[model samples]
Target: MDAILRAAGEVLGTELSEPVDLGGSPRTVVLRCRTASGGSVVVKKYGTEPDDLRAFTAEAAGLSLRLAGPELLGVDDSIPLLVMEDLGSAPTLADVLLGNDPQAALDGLSAWARGLGRLAVASVHRRADLAALSAGYGMGVPSWDEEPWLLRHAAEFPAALAGIGVEAPPELAGELERIAATGANEYLAFTPGDTCPDNNLLTPDGLRLIDFESACYLPVFMTAAYCRMPFATCWCVFTLPAGLAEKIEETYRTEVVEAYPQLVEDEIWQPGIRRAVALWTVYLTTNLIPRMAKDEPAHRTRRPVPTLRQLLRHRWETASTLEEFPAFAETMRLLLRDVAGDWDVPPLPGYPAFGDFG
Candidate 1:
């Protein structure tokens, strides 16, 4: 610990002390430390593990874009550590959503949408710049935008379902291929990769995002699906009240439409967004189903969070209605019948902020 603080202090030209551990994953150690000048800087040091290096590379490269997040004060790639401006304590979006004010949650959700949309607009053509910075950090990990998530997760679909005693439909492969092709379309933009609710801080100035470790470019719909699935990859899942999801989705779409004017059309917009939703449903099957063996909060510290079965059932219910993929829709239906249908859990409730709605 002394050696790492010393290394980080050298980068900032000030000795750091009074370190407070800021719970990071096994891949990194994050600290909120007081500098010699009595100010605080968050110092993060990545582990020697290969994936840790990749995560470090992504964060350093993403913050360098200055699109969002704390200002990157300094980096010593040799130690694989970062010294960043402290944004100070602020309530996270998760905090707001889980609180008592429905209106605060509503406003926060809209602002979050607008902020992410503008970020996508700002980062549209900067892939190579991100690539160049990434190479300098961790021997050049692959840009996650190009990671073939759709095809890879879809390919795993059949086997994942089979593990649960449900056989995938024969024509499911064709539907998966179609959505994967749409996933590869030209409407790409940069995202912080892990835009889960807790990953961003709702500061007085605006929503200042953090945790750029999974940063990469991806189709805009990959994120737009969050507003539809109402947060596809987040641990803070709950039912959105009537019309709330679409309203926020429009708040986001309104900003991105500035970059791609054709997004104004339902023909161009609906199909892309729905396909992204389908892709994420497949993702949920692989990522969440195995976990359904037990019931617990999706997050360790947050309440009213959905359980794995709750999330899976919600996703499958939505996917079951996809007009574009009959085979896939049928598959979702079968899972609903054989897997989550008999569970004793109540229907997933609305966000806690909505008070009686839940």
Candidate 2:
């Protein structure tokens, strides 16, 4: 912990004190440290391993973009650490969503979606700049939208289904290939990559996003899926109240329309969102199918959370409704019918905060 703080301190040209451990993944050590001026800053240090360095580079590159996240304070390439503005004690969107107050959760959700939309609109013109920044960082981690990453995930879905003794539909591959092209050329924007609920702080100033390890540019619909599915990649899975999601989505759409006017049309917007939903559903399926043999929480500690089986079932149910991707829809049905039918998990439930609304 001292080493991490020392690296940050060296970058900031001061001695840091009062180090508090902020939990991190295997690849990182995060600390909230006090500076000489009695102010707090976050020190994030990445390991020297390949993937860890990639994450560090992406984060440094991302924060330097000066987008909606915490401000970039200092960086040390030798240890690949970042000293950033401390957002301080603010309740995160995840905290609000997981709590008992419905009004607070509603406000958090609306602000998160709208804030993301504005972030998207604001970031539309900075794609080349971000690319240059990542290149300068030298980790060579390609942005999600720049690479055919969704296609890679899509390709793995059939094999994952086969592992569970299910056959892939004949036309599923073709549908996935076509859908993979959605945000590759247009309608692109920068994203923190993992906009899970826990990563979004509902600060008094507004929604402040953090966790830029997987940050990159991606399709706008890819993010809209979060508002549509309401936290698509997050462990904080819960159904938003009926009509509330649409309102949230519209709030986002209203802002992003400034960058891509074509998205103002439902013809373009709705279909794109469906394609993203299908891809994300498939992405989750591929990642989780290998582990669903034993039921586990989506997160280690967070509770009232859905089990792996339940989350997959919920995703399949939603993805099956896509009219544009017939084979993909059929595949979701096949998974729902042939694979997940005997999982013995309960149906996914609404957010605890919204439980009373129903």
lDDT of 2 by residue, 271-333 (tens): 888888988898888888888989999888777688888888898999899967888888888
- Local accuracy of candidate 1 as per-residue lDDT tens digits, 1-358: 8988999999999999989898887799999999999899999999877678788889999999888899999999888899999998898888889889988899889888999999999988898889788776754455555467678899888888889899878888877987888647578899998887888799999999999988988889989999988888888888888898999999999999998898899998899888889988888778877688897777776676777778778888888999678899899899999988788877888788987435
Whole-model lDDT, candidate 2? 0.85
Please give the RMSD of candidate 1 to the true structure: 1.7
lDDT of each: 0.86, 0.85
lDDT score, candidate 1, position 267: 90
- The best candidate by TM-score is 2
Looking at model 1, report the run of 10 residues with the lowest lDDT sum. Answer: 138-147
Candidate 2 Cα errors over 4 Å, as ranges: 140-146, 356-358
Best model number under lDDT: 1
The C-alpha RMSD of each candidate to the native structure, in angstroms, is: 1.7, 1.7
